[model samples]
Target: MLQVRLLGCFALEQSQRDQSAVLGRNGRRLAAYLFAYPNRSHRRDKLIDLFWTESAPDQGRTAFSTALWKIKRTIGASGRQMALHAVGQNVVLEIAKPAIVDAHRFASDIEVALSASCADSIRPAIELYSGAFLEEFDGDWVLEERERLEVLYVRALTLMMRQAANQSRYEDALCCARRILATDPMRESAQRATMLLYTLNGQRGQAIRQFERCRATLREECGVDPMPETRSLDLMIRSGAVFERIPTLLNETFGTGG
Candidate 1:
């Protein structure tokens, strides 16, 4: 079985060995495109338009043909049944046996986790998101799907964080919160969550410092102050007030809930 990894980096592995070198860079991109839309027939002309636009029409056609042929040859040499097929005017990726596409599996696992009540069910999906979708590749075609998967990744992390906090696992919850902030420093809700978690973990100084960082980030990026709720939280913490779980506050604020 061919394992296609479209998350983080682009790789095609078979029998636990890397086969990406067989396709080279451009060949890998072409193959990755087909796997990104697996089992779907993509018109050859459309592919030429997408990948060979920089060349003259004749040159583009020749390049497209060469790329497609290379893809076919590489897959054929894998010692497995054909994974690429030419049907009528379109090309299709139809692995004879099951293939593991990380993007597909991530979506499927996350979908199942979303519908389940058990928080632990989300772990598998979270672990599958190794990094941004196709982190090494970029184009107009990749943006929407990349953003979509990133949103799912952040959502999964947030769910895990809240569940851990609810269970009084401050350290674990803080880890998730920090990851969220790392992915998106502009996320004030995650910043707030981090602050709260730090205080809960008996690190009041770090909590105050987190607030200062949030205030600085918002001011620098948006030229604005922290939201009122965040400001209030900062004040309470600075005044040495007793802390409590303010998940409700996070939910009602101008950003995603903690």
Candidate 2:
């Protein structure tokens, strides 16, 4: 099996062989673009523009053709099996059988989890999403796909936090919230979840410190203050009122639904 890992550092892994002859940068990009949006045909001209826009028409076509050949050679049978081919000016990646694409699998698993409304079912999706989709690549297309996956990751963490909280798994919930904050420090909801979990664990001092950490992150990152809701939580922690409430609207705050 040839596994294309787009999450975290991008690497193409084959189950039974060395990947010494990896694709070139442009080859990798073409492979990633096709794998990221599998089973679709992309016009050769569009791919040329996307990846080799600065080149003259001939140079771009030459570069694209070279990159395509490199990709085919690097990925070999799996590439052929998946129909990673060009036909009459269109390129395609068609995987009729199973293939492990972390980006694609992450999105699919999340949809299933969301459909079931079961955060527990989402654990695999969260685990699959090790990092932003193709974090090493750059381009307009890469940025859009990266940001979209990042948002899904954050939302998945939100669901996990709420689930663990409901299950009284305070530590697990806090861990999920921290993971979310690590990726998106501006997420006040995650910060709040962290603070609440600390409080629930009888770590009031830690809860207050989390609030301070949140404030500092916002100040340094965005030159802004915490939202009013966050400030209120901070005040509640300071006044020893956090333990008095159950973090009301438990279902409302972290719900992934409408």
Say which candidate scores most in lDDT: 2
Error of 1 at 143 (Å): 1.1
Regions of candidate 1 where Cα sits further than 4 Å from its true position: 15-17, 77-82, 96-99, 242-258
Stretch of 10 with least lDDT, candidate 2 = 249-258
**Candidate 1 lDDT, tens digit per residue, 220-257?**
99999988878888887788663453555445432335
lDDT of 2 by residue, 156-224 (tens): 777788888887888998898889988988888788878877987899999999999999989998999
TM-score of each: 0.87, 0.90
- Give me the displacement of residue 214 in model 1, in angstroms: 2.2
Clashing pairs in 1: none
> How large is the C-alpha RMSD of every model relative to the true structure?
3.2, 2.9
